[model samples]
Target chain A: MKPVIEIESISKKFLIPASSQGYQTLRESLTSLDFLRKKREFWALRDISFSMEQGETMGVIGNNGAGKTTLLKILSRITKPTSGKGRINARVASLLEVGTGFHPELTGRENIYLNGVILGLKKREIDRHFDEIVEFAGVKEFLNTPIKHYSTGMWARLAFSVAAHLDPEILLVDEVLSVGDAEFQKKSLVKMNDLSKNGRTVIFVSHNLAAVRQLCSRCMLISQGEITSIGNVNDVITEYTSFRDGDSPGTTDLTLISERKGSGIVRLTRIELRNSDEQVKGTFLMRDDLHIHLWLEAPVKVRNVKIVVDILNSFGETITSMFDSDSGFGLIEVEGSEHISITINDIRFYPGKYNISVSVISQILNHKYESFDEIENAITFDVENQLVNRNLTRRTGLLFLTPDWQIHKD
Target chain B: MAGYEIKPSGWLTFDFRELWHFRELFLFMTWRDIKVKYKQTFLGLAWVVLQPLALMAIFTVIWLKVMKPAELDIPYPLFAYSGLVFWGLFSSGISGAGESMISNANIIKKIYFPRIIIPASAALTALFDFVVTLFLLVLLILYYQIDVSLPRFAGLFSLSIMITMAASFGIGLIVSAATIRYRDFRYVMPFFLQAFFFVSPVVYPLALLSSDSLRIVLSLNPLAGAVTLARAAITGNPANWQAIFPGTLMTVFLLVAGLTLFRRNESSYSDLL
Candidate 1:
């Protein structure tokens, strides 16, 4: 029996504009010719080849820009590879993103047919599954109403429902379960689990390690556009976890980091991590006191300032968020520049790499709050395990806590 | 459905079988285009009929009063309205098909369909508007009690509309694909269409041009041939093979060129978009 998917030396090269300045792209389009434009070559996927058999559910885990999506795109024929070729022996359905072709002006019923057809399902099939799709989405009464009126959750649910009902021989899904309400996320995950159990070829690309471990029998880890590991789920995941470059630099010049989104009312200029001694450092031992020094510059007067820091695990799960207001210390004003020292008395995280996402928010009149600057994965640090307590040397949980125990025999 | 191979191919790849399989998608997309066209508008679909009807009325008054030409055998208003229907299909259809690719970038990036269908569906939305306006012509014909044979007019009507759609689809395919690379077409197209409208035999009949050279030059436009055929059907006049031949040839050329260019560039669309 032939494998459901086979490829030989598939590689994808992208020619990005040399100065890919978004501003120049639009302005130069009117003046310059296509051939005259300078472009820099970058390989998104490098000599990557893999085959999957029927009923084999493979999870593709990768960091951002790791070519996982590019691999899937090539398989799904959304984008042609720069070189090499591949063959699939069965019909393939790819959900690169849910609500792909949904138009806000279109009603839920209309969008279902539209999204269904875009996903390669036939009209009659959609008709046959119409009731099921509507029921699964649970927006039947509002089916005729334009989807613009639907809440974000409703939109995601309806989009997911249409995609979930698509029955194809091979499925290539990319983090579709990462959205929507928790219940809907579970429903789609269960549906995917059933798809694989029913012997359909599935390639799931996601950052959620737990879900990947649950739904995928085998796993592939990609780093810098190459497959670093592919085999047993736990082995691949362990290899992936080990590849994390945990020790980030002690300071980041926030002004130079252009990959940020906000109104820019008050811009963050620099961020530094220091130990209790105030010496600049990023790595820390468990239970060590840490100080996050944030330097801000406000060209204009900013009122009621707020600084928020979100601690995320290696799997992109938010462990907790710290806000200045939590200590009853916000509602400050800044004119030109201000240095903020957020002192954490005890860092109660277990040994692992954790990401620190920073956000600068402003409180306006009428109790309206808007984040002016927010950067996900702005800084990352390693938490080294220090066996302060001999009994808890082998930590099993993500948090380090000292709980008083009352010994009793029942 | 047979699975497809994913490899880079050169210039021409026509997958009629794939297109046949995606026929439902084409219909649905066309339906979506037609459905959402007038949403949130005060008049809704009434705008579709009103556009051509109003244009026909104004053109009728202008041609009759300003030109003050010698009387023709066909009624001026019917001549002008039918001509508008023919022109409308070519103009709006091409425009729709031309903008289809760039406008539907969301679906194009996420999924694969016959790239031709994007333009085809956009043109179909315009054709839907054409059909809505065609009803006005039928009314004019009934109101005038014009001696129109059903079968003969039907054949000519379908043939003319087919030619017009081909021309629009062909041009749309070229323009839409080109617009992806060079945005100049987005601005250049409106001027081209306005100029094309005057050049075609829409508001004025071919007979108005006394010189054969001018008449033949106008026939080079596919819409002129469509207008000639549609006029022949509406008035029960003998088909003008002399005027229709050149435009038909251009339509075939445009269709071939459009398909070839669109296919060649389609593979990289997701990236470019």
Candidate 2:
């Protein structure tokens, strides 16, 4: 089969200034010779090469800032690669974001035509699919009303409906399916499956591994702007997950992980898992006491801080979350290094691997919460069943809950 | 499936065929601009004519009462109004087109349509406004009882509007491209237009300038020639080809230079934006 999309040694470089200026005016740069000295080159993508045959659904899995969006942009022709080239041999449609070109003041009906044209459809083609789009979005009643008045969900649905109806020979999607409700996400996945089955090529970039595993025939793993592996979906995803988990489970240096976002006032310096005896351990047994130790730092005296920890199953589904506020501990003040511990009496996580994500937020003067730090899947650990000589099969679902039943003689 | 290569090309090359293929997008964008411009406004499309009419009234007072320049063959209101119709086209067209890219950065960053379509749609939207105001111009002409010369009026009117369009589009291309990198253009643009207004002879006639060299230099401004030719068309004055030729050349030069600069930076726009 002929490749529908071919990328040859493509790389993208961006210029970064050493100074922390958000944006400099031309006048300031022209007047100061120091500006020229501060400029530096930052490579966003390095030597990325790949090709996809017709009807292949290729998934791109990576951590944040792994150059996935940059690659998609290059293929979609939104920006050119600084070096190398890409050849696209089909009508291409890219959904970098849904409702990208929507005009707020335009009626839903008018926007359908406008967005359709933007997606490379002719007027008559839009007319033919107009009813289908309106029906799919379930906005037929409000078609004549301006989009500014529509609820956000309705707007996303309309935008997704239009994009889903696009009949391009090649589609480049970037995280747009995560929007709208779960029913719509399911519908979109089904629609994408249909498109692939119909022999249209697709390049899907997403962080949702489950969706990628279900939809993609092949997958590529990118790490720090380079392709680490490319082949079967399961193989690539395994490589990606293993790399993310590191060689030692439940032992991660919070400072070393670059995929974190928040204000710089507070930081999560370190994390540790401890047992009831105050000994640190990576592996725990089912029904054992699970203790999480967090080391935090604040540059200045900060108050009203709340920390949250979420336990996720192997498939990246959240099993449960613990919030500091639930214990009626409204505030914690930190000026420097401080250690906090969270102890769960019963683990109940049934003999499987699970990951933990931590987040820190603070309440401001107006009583609105501002995020201070958030790290997803920061550490992974395994749970084992230690009970012996009992015909006990490892439980099937998320947790092995202990329930007591009392029976009365009838 | 139409195949295309994504290699670096020389700065002067442009894909006019690709732009032509995306003409439907241009039309739709233009339609969107026109629709959104008047959506919530009370007067709606009337604002298109009202803006120039309001400007004409202020300029008439300033030019007639304050400057008190030398008389021409036509009424002062007619002279100022005629000049304003084209001036409005040039100024508003360039402003609209120049800001098109920055305003549509969301679309540009996501999709793969010809980038030129954005500015072109803005120019066309301004053209629609110009057409709307032309009716008011016709009413003013009839009200003032200005004699119309059919053969000369038809040819010169179209040429004048075309000249304005070309000049606006040319400048607009450069401005829109620059705006992506240097957002200071957002603040600089209004001031630049205001300064350009005085130099374009929108209120006073070009003949009011005493020195021959001064008039010739002023005529080099594309709007100067367009406004002069349009005034002549309405007032039945003989066309000044000598004065108009220099401006037409400048218009062509601006258009070529603007397009070359625009095409050179087209691919990088998304990056900067």
Best by DockQ: 2
Q: Which 10-residue window in model 2 chain B sums to the lowest lDDT?
A: B6-15
Q: List runs of model 2 lying over 4 Å from the truth.
A: A243-248, A259-269, A291-311, A320-345, A357-375, A387-395, A408-410, B8-12, B211-213
Give model 2's TM-score versus the native structure. Answer: 0.92
Q: After best superposition, candidate 1 residue B26: deviation in angstroms?
A: 0.9
Number of the predicted model whose TM-score against the real structure is largest: 2
DockQ scores of all models, one per candidate: 0.55, 0.64
Tens digits of lDDT, candidate 2, B116-156: 88998999999999999999888888898877988889899
Worst 10 residues of 1 chain A by lDDT: A18-27
lDDT at position A156, candidate 1? 94
Question: Each prediction's Cα lDDT score?
Answer: 0.85, 0.84
Residue B190 lDDT in candidate 2: 99
Residue A308 lDDT in candidate 1? 86
Query: Compared with the true structure, what per-residue lDDT tens digits does model 1 show for residues A290-359?
Result: 8888888889898888888887776556788987878888847888988988888888887777767788
Each candidate structure's TM-score, on Cα atoms with residue i matched to residue i, is: 0.87, 0.92
